[model samples]
Target: MITLSRRHLIGMGAGALAASAVVGALPASAGVKGYVQSTIARMSLPEKVGQLMVQEVYGVDPTVDDSRNLSKYGTAKGVDVVRDLHLGGVIYFAWTNTYDNGPDGVAAASNALQEASLETRPKGRPDRPVGTKVAVPLLIATDQEQGIVTRFGPPATQFPGSMALGAGRSTKDARTAAAITGKELRAVGINVDFAPDADVNVNPDNPVIGVRSFSSRPDLVADMVAAQVVGYQIDGKVCASAKHFPGHGDTATDSHYGLPEITHTPEEWKALDAPPFEAAIRAGVDMIMTAHLLVPALDPSGDPASVSRPILTGVLRDQLGFDGVIVTDALDMAGVRQKYGDAEVAVRAMEAGVDLLLMSPAPLAARDAVLEAVRTGRLTEAQLDEKVARVLTMKYRRGIVERPLCEPALVDRIVGIPQHLEAADEVTDRTVTLVSNDGTLPVDVTDRRVLVCGWGATTTTAVADALARLGATTTRQTSNAPTAAQITAAVTAARSSDLVVVLTNNVATSASQVNLVKALTGSGTPVVTVAVRNPYDVAYYEANAELCTYSYSPVIAGAVARVITGRVNPQGRLPVDVPKPGGGVYLSFGDGLSY
Candidate 1:
């Protein structure tokens, strides 16, 4: 299994040129190949290494500029280093994305970043004409895998989560939601969405990806993944990464906390986990985001798939034939960061065959590590050339070279517009799943006394608004965590009212939520429970009627109320299976009973 490094041919240019067919294993686009090759030819070793590292947007201030020392670039502020470090991209986390994150602020930041990304100092850099603009664009990427994983928003209309879309079961709706998602992202100059999770939610007890996945069935997940790939890539040209590949669905462990493993054999892997990824590739997905999953069946050494040669190179690149960009999940996660520094992770990840190093904590240090790896005869120059060329091809394919900057006025106008909200409402209306009922729903609000007890800020308001609008004599009580007195008050209110509507969250995480629901139902009044976050609540507490609305967005809440009042028939099916209280099957996958 030993292959010599191509470091011996550093000075030999034309003779050392690798096969064009194998250079980065690009898509069948010849022009992109030529552009990538030419781009690679002009870049320095430092620039090429820098292009592989993607950093978080912390300390990145595009507004700051410091003069170069004719031999080196000085000063800090990550955004200014776009040109200095020749960075590949910066991922927007919640902190930086929302720091002074007004529409105008985002536009200014984006403009500054693009400007720096396209221009460079005339210091210690060669192979470029004086004052010439760089043709490459940074991959402005973020995790807008909406419905739990959202980085930037408020001006963006909130769509129902992915599992909700699966329950809705319309590929068109899924695409439309992502179209809106993409357009809003592009409005703010984010050109890549690390989204449309391709994991099939087969485990009922799966923690991180319950409502995030489209469905428990592989076929349904494939459909939603393909649809979202089209939706994000089509209109705004924002690249979509069909994510957590080969699959992160069935694992009980959270990658954020510890490494999760999949012990299936190769045959079982293909049958259960690989379909969505296969479908995503077929759908022309621009990027595939790898998970930190350890598949002992694939790689016996127990390397996380992010750095597993068998998985990334053998399975993803060779077996599945995904020629587009391959990106690692955030390198800072506990799953992959076990005693590995930025330098070690960056070098090995590239060796494992990933194109992009996402969310490296010390990105500059990482760039230097790879640079040292190349110079010290550890990593080959040929590897750097191919990797950087692949990234350039991706930038070209995404049209970022031509149009890197976003329009500020258009951003304000297009993002979170009425049409987007309307479309979002339409999708949520379809995604509300009526789990079960004993004829307790459509709680007539016309002069009927109603008691509303809900969790969270938005959900409480939305439920109260819907009831008030429906002509119900409504009394509202809100608590994410209710005191004993508060619980008694809610029960007292429920007893006095004709019917009670309860909105709750996270029955699996908190037993207090289960207790809250039990107390509300104890009044023996006709009680309707809406699982505000996770749908597994019905397994713990019984309500006269139960519905699972994947999101508690104002629009989704309104839509939930409409469904309960029989305004819109609850059409969404259960995307994941819900286990029974005593530990057997309660609602199987695809179970949704409507009035």
Candidate 2:
């Protein structure tokens, strides 16, 4: 068994915070007292403080140093504070190679992390009450929001984002995918998942949560939110959080940049954005993460939702009746750090009924301030007890109390098992949407030379691979727009050939890419705009026919190919509002085709 020194623990805690200020710095080993004991017991001031600060883990460290990734274990020298400060948990930013448990190695890494922590506990703490033995286990968490926001497998299967699933208009699919996501998460030792973004995609041009959100319609969002909650919480896989409450979808700005304000009236709030949360509460979701955006209608005093009582306690708890943990968005993000000091914000969050104060820039200072507030009666000890109790309740319910040691030998079997990867492939396959089509799809180029063009035209490499598998002669070109020379070349090649297939995977960020699509439209021949991005761009082209397949993922690519070949009928519908060119939006919130 590894021995943890008092000195080692202190150093880890301090190092973890210091590392966050500057990149390439190492994080202190997380949590001091063993997970079992740390779970209970009146913690020392430093230990209590440590539990509140969680830094992002990049990868494993070899020697605790400037170049280390604090999140990965068995790599670098351990940061001392993790053992000394008695921190609560660590959020993995990226996974180490060691993190392969079954279901794409989600559980294996979790097993290894917990096993390592258990070995380092002081000799006195036993796994169980062999005549009053004490133990404390660490809580491990991940952002397994499914779809595009994953950090698990190189070949890990990905589901369409929540919005895409919503577009499919089936709660059954949402629930099943969530359950699959949970299985993968649990197999990796991740007990907490920050997921099921309940935000309705109200703003189509919203830069960030476009497809990540469910639907613009609150009712559909509510059902999908309920499905996600059920899927994760079932079969004891993991705890679920329906997040960015009040809602992140209505705002046009990204909270990652700065505090965003949602300017809805109270009536608009209850009618549109609040239904999903209400549905989540009814479903008994485990946690709720607050958004950093400022909503004047929710809290006219102008405080962000994370520190606002009206939103956190009054609306979320009292109105919606949610009594679980309320974790704030990362405090280190610009939304909070740019405005207030960590300690001040931490204390206010507690006052506002936030049970978990996460990702603080100054963990020590923030932890100390919250403790002091309680000690000085600014925040009562009773309040501290309540907050800690909620955390403990989650831990106990999740079976973190006994500090079970995952068998190290089982790690190999659990990490990246083949079945889960297949699941990812299938989920991705099923989610490809065929938004719109003109008559000219399913191109047959048996003997004809096919000319493919546009940005990410290479993404069609998968489609090309399939065509190669089927023994088709194809020529692919990489150009934003075909020049007059390029067009003449294409027409010359096509003058005697069968058909023209214009594969367009344009990036929406640049206006130039949109112009390129228009340029490619009238190139003296029949053309099809095969859109593999935001399908809204398809309107720019005057192709004889057009097809929309919203992603370039292998499974989605395969699905798109099948749809084009007439093997599969078009099934997916547009879930969020897709912008129409010339100042009109094509799709709106709540637009879906049930199958």
Task: Compare the candidates by lDDT and give the number of the best one.
Answer: 1
TM-score leader: 1
Q: Per-residue lDDT tens digits of candidate 2, residues 1-595?
A: 2222346434554332122222111111222223324334634444444455554433343123322443232223333334433546666655433333223233434433443333333334554112221223456777767655665544444565676677677887788778876765665467777888888877756666766777788898999999999998874367888888989887778888888888889999889889988898888888899999898988988789999999999999998889988999888777766567878999998899898877776766777798789778889865665676677666655655433323334434544457755655555545555544455555554544555555565465666555545445666666665566665555565444344555664445555545544554544556656666555556555566665555544445556555555555556666666666656776554342212
Candidate 1 residues 1-595, lDDT tens each?
1111235323222321222212323334457767677777777777777788776554334554323212122444545566666778877766653335555566556655665565534544564323333335678888887777766667678887788899899999999989998988888778999988999877767888888899888899998989999999986589999989878998999998899988788888888789999999998998999998789888988788998888999999999998888999998788888747767888888889988998776665677788888888888999878778777877877877556666666876888889889898889999998887998876667888888886886677778778778777778898887788888888989888888888888777777777888998889788899887777777888889999987665567778778878888888888878888678888787888877
TM per candidate:
0.90, 0.81
What value does the lDDT take at residue 257 in candidate 1?
A: 84
lDDT of each: 0.77, 0.62
The 10 consecutive residues of candidate 2 with the worst lDDT sum are: 19-28
lDDT of model 2, residue 336: 69
For every model in order, what is the number of clashing pairs?
0, 51
TM-score of 2: 0.81
lDDT of 1: 0.77
lDDT of 1 at 556: 75
Candidate 1 steric clashes: 0
Stretches of candidate 1 off by over 4 Å are 1-30, 59-61, 64-75, 97-99, 124-135
